[model samples]
Target: MGRKRKTKIFMIMIAFVLFLAGCNFNSSESSNEETGGSEGETKQVLNISTTADIPTLDSTKAHDGIAFTVLNNVNEGLYRQDENNEPIEALVTEHKENEDKTVHTFTLRDSNWSNGDPVTAQDFEYAWKRVMKDASPYNFMFVTAGIKNSEAIMNEEMDTEDLGIKAIDEKTVEVTLEAANPLFQSLMTFPTFLPQNQKFVEEQGDQYALEAENVLFNGPFTLVDWTHEQGWKYEKNEDYWDADAVKLDAINAYVVKDPAAGINLYETNKVDRIVLSSEAVDQNKDDENFDTILEPEILFLRFNHNHPVLGNKNIRQAVNMAIDKKSLTDVILKNGSTPLDGIVPKGFFKSPAGEDFRDINGDFNTGTVEEAQKVWETGLKEAGVEEVNVSINIADSEDHKKVAEYIQAQLEDNLPGFKLNIKAVPFAQRLEIEKAIDYDLSLSSWGPDYSDPMTYLDMWLEGGSANRMDYSNAKLEELVASARTETDLEKRYQMLLDTEKILLEEDAAIAPLYQDGTAVLMRSKIKNLLVHPTGASFSYKWVTIEE
Candidate 1:
C-alpha cells in the first residue's frame, strides 16, 4: 500500500527528550522506582503519539499509514522490511522460483497467532484470495505484481480460487505470476499481503478486525487495547516465532492532534515522542532530541474532474499554476518540506539511467502571478463563466488547516474570478468524503507502497480505486499498463516517465503541493525504532528503551 498507498494525515514521532525542569523528573523517577530499575536498566515500555486515530485494523481494507503501521506490527506477512527497507523473510522459512521465474513457492515458518492458531500456508492462500474476492482497495497491487489470473479474477472473469495462488501443503504455498516482477518480494512486505486465520475471520464475520479483541495477531506485537479516536496499546507477542528479537515489552500510542498537548506529554514523562508542528519546530529545533525525517509522501490538491468547473482542463491548469507552493512549504510547512511541481518526490527513485526521476521530468505547472492570471482568464473564457466557486476538503489538524487556509488564499488572490471555500473535517471523515468523490477538491497525500515510481504513476489509472479525482487519459492508462508488464528495465522506466508527463503536465490531474518532512522530538534513550521512507513508516519490533 505506498505509504499504504493512501497516506493518512498523521505525523509519526519516534524518539524523546527529557525536560530540564526539575519537577518534571519526578514522573521519570517514580516510573523507574515502580519498575525497580537502576541507572542502566532497560525499560521495556515505549510511549508515542499519532496525530489521528487508526481508521481500521483489517489488513485488506487498510489504505492509510496509521492502519498500515498498526497492521504491520500486529500481523506477520510472508516477508518483512528490515531496518534498511529491504525485504527479509518473516513468516516464510524459505522461498524458491521456477525456471521461468514466474512460479514461486514459500515454506511457512512455525508461528502462532495471538489466539494460538498456527500460522500456515493456507492462511496466506485464504487471505490473498479474500483480497481478490472483496475487490480490496489495494487489489491493484496484485495486478501490478503481475500475479497470474489476478486481473481476471478482479474483473469477475475468473473465480478467486483460480487466482494462481495455492497451498500446496500445510506448510508450503505456491504462487504463479503473469510475469516476473522484480518488486514482488518488496510487495510482500506490505500489510495487505498479511495472512489471516480463515476460521477466526469467518467466525467474527462482519465484526472482524473492528477492534483489538476481534482480530488475531501473528507479528511481534499484539494489539491489547483500542479506544477508538483516543488511543491504543500493544504488548510484545511472546508466542511470536522470533520473540527473542523483540525488545519493547509494551507500546502505548495516543491520538494527540494538538501539538502542545503532545509536547506537554513528552515534558511530563508521559510520552517518549511527539511530532512537532511548524511553530513547535521553530521552538524546539535547538533541543537535543529534535530530528527531521524526509518521507516520500507528497501532498497535493485533487480536482474532481467530474465537476463542471474542474472538468475544464484549462481551469485545472490555471488552478495548478496559481498556487504559491514555495510559500506554502517555506512558511506554513517549515519542517524541511519542499515545494513540488510533480507527483513523485525527489530522491524517491532513480531511472535505469541512474538519474533522479524528478530531475528527468523537471518542473510542471510552475507559473508566476502574471502567467497565472492569463491562464485563469483563458480558463474562464473557455468555461463561459464569469467566476467559479469551489471548495477544498481538508483534515482539521492544525497543520492541514493552516495549509488549506494558505492554499485558499493563494488560489483566490492569484487566480481572478476564482472563489475557494475551505471545508475542515476530521481525518477519517475527510478520507471517506474524498473516496466517495463528494467534494469539489481535496487536500490529499500519498506515500509510496514500495520504492518504485510505479507506486505513484499507477494511482491515476483510469478506473483505479485510488483515482478518486475522476481524472483519466487513454494515453496515461496505456503507458502505465505497458510499464507494469514490461520486463526491460529501461523501457519500463521510460514508460513511467511518459505516464507521469501525461498525468501531470498534459491533463493536470492533480495540483502538486509539497513533499512531506516531519520534524520530531525524541528521547535519547530510545534505540532502533526503524523508520522507513515508504510503506508502513515505523517498525517497533526491535525498538529498545535504554536508561
Candidate 2:
C-alpha cells in the first residue's frame, strides 16, 4: 500500500522465497554487431531498457513512477532529497517557517529558464495556484486544504491567492497555511509538488502535457520530443543549475512489456538496461553482472465494490480464500516479494507498541479458505446469485499478463463453476479503462507520494477517487482523516491498523496479492549512475559512462 511497507515486504520475501531465487541470473550483455543504419553522427545516448514505458511527459498527467523517473531527469522541484535522503535546497536557497508552522518563506535562486528568463517566485506561485484549481487531477489539493480558505478557493468561491501563497518579491515568496504540517517540507520534494509554468498551462489547458515541444524545464534535463503514450527521450539541459552531475547525453525510453524481448535486447546490446523475468532470472543466475534491488511497489487485485457480486463482503471473502498468495510468491515470483497478510503491508509506520498496520488475526489467506467459504455461500444464497463469472483487468506487461493467467487458472480450478476472464490491455488503454470503472476487477497498486498513511487510505474512497476502484467506506475515511492530524508516527500507525482491519473484515473491496519488488539489469560499462534505496531514480548530473 505504501512504499516503506512494500519495500520491507520485498526484502523479507528474499528469505521466504529463497528457493525460487534460482531465477537470479546474469548473462553477458555484449553486442559485437555493427551499426550501419544511421548516415549522420550517432547521438551519445545512455540507453535504458525497461519492461514499462513512460505514459506521459506532462507532470500533471503523470502518475506512474516510470514517468516520474524521466521527469526527474527532465524537470526539478523547489527542494530535493540528496543521497542521504535529506531535503536540501534545490530551487529555493532557504526557507523560513512561521512560529505556528502555518506559514513558510522561501528564497529562490537566480536561475534562468531554458529560454533565459529568470526563474522566480512568481512562477512557483502561479503554478501552485493552477494546481489548486478544480481542473487539476492531483491530490496535492488535499495538502493545500490547510491553507486558509483553500477549500472554498478551490470550489471557485473565492479569489486566487486567497488560498495562502504569495510572491513577496522577484526572489522571495511566502506560504501561509490553515494549520501546522510538519511533513510539508518533505511533501514538497514530491513530483506532485513540482512547479509548472502557469502561463503555459493556463493557455494550453488539456493540450499542455500532450507534447514535449509544449513544455519547459528548470531541471537536469529537458524532454526534447514527445509522442504521447509512445516513448519520449530526454537530453541534458545545458542551463541546469547542477549540470555537472548530469551524465547521460540523452535517454531513450520505449513503451514495452515483453520481458523476453527486453532481455534479448539487453543481451544483444540493443538496450543497456532491461527488466528480467523469473524464467530469465533462473536461466542466468550465474552471470558475473547479476544484480538485485528491491523497490517500494506492489501488484494488488482491486475488487470493484460497485459490482453486484464483488460488492458483497461474503463474495469478496470467498474470492480471497480461493487464491493462494504464498504460491504466487514462493513458486512463481522467485524474484523477491512477500505474500501480503492484509491491505496494509508490513514496514509501514509502527505503533507506540510497535504494532504493524496489518491485522494478525483476521487476515484471510490459504489457511482461512474454509472460513471464507461459509461467508461466501451465505452471501451467494442471499443475493440469489447462481453463477459467478468475473474478469480481471491488467496492463499489457509480460508479467502482468502471466500473473492474470495464473490468477484466472487458480480461481477456475479452485472454485468450481466460477468463470474467469482476462483482459490484457496496453499501458494507456488500461489506464483509461480503469478510470472509466469498466472492468469487473483489475490489478492495481498504489505508491505513496509521501510517507504518511493517508496516501494509501485515500484510495479506498467511493467512486474510486484515486484510481477509480469504485470503493468507498465511511468508517475507513474517518480513520484516515483523524490519522493525518497525528504527528505521532506510532499512534498514526495504530490508527492505520484499525482502519485496515475494518476494510479487510467488512469492506473487502480489494484482494491484495503480493508486495512488489522490482528486478532490473544494468550494463557493466556504465559508471556513476545514482541509484538510491528508494528505487531507480538516476541523476545524470553526477553520472558517467565508460568508453
Tell me, by TM-score, which candidate is best.
Answer: 1
lDDT of 2: 0.66
RMSD of each: 6.6, 9.0
| lDDT (C-alpha) at residue 445 in model 1 | 87
TM-score of each: 0.93, 0.85
Cα lDDT computed for each candidate against the true fold: 0.86, 0.66
Give the true-structure RMSD of model 2.
9.0
Q: List model 2 lDDT by residue over 1-547, tens digit each.
A: 9999888756654532341123121112211112122355333466665556566666655667676677677777777766665566888888898788888999988776676677778887777776666445564434433566665664668876575878899889888877888667766766656667766666777776667766778888787755443445667787888877665566656444656556655665656777678777787667766676554455678777778887777777777787888888767776777787575556754446755555443364434656656766777886678768989889888778778888888777766567889998876677778788888889886666655555666566543336476777788878866876777776666677677777676666677788776666777776767654331255555555565
On a 0 to 100 scale, what is the lDDT of residue 448 in model 2?
61
Worst 10 residues of 1 by lDDT: 14-23
Model 2, position 219, has a per-residue lDDT of 88
Candidate 1 lDDT over 1-547, as tens digits, reads 5675233322222222322122122234444454454577776888888988898899988889999999989889999999899999998888999988999999998899888879888998999989999988888888977889998887789999898889999899999999888889999899988899999999999999898899999999998778776778788899999999998777778777778778778886778888999989889999999998788999998988889778887888888888888888888888889989998899999988799999999999878888888888887888789999989999988899899899888888888778889999989898989889999999998999999999999999776788887777988878987888787999988898898889888888889999999998999999998998767989999998876
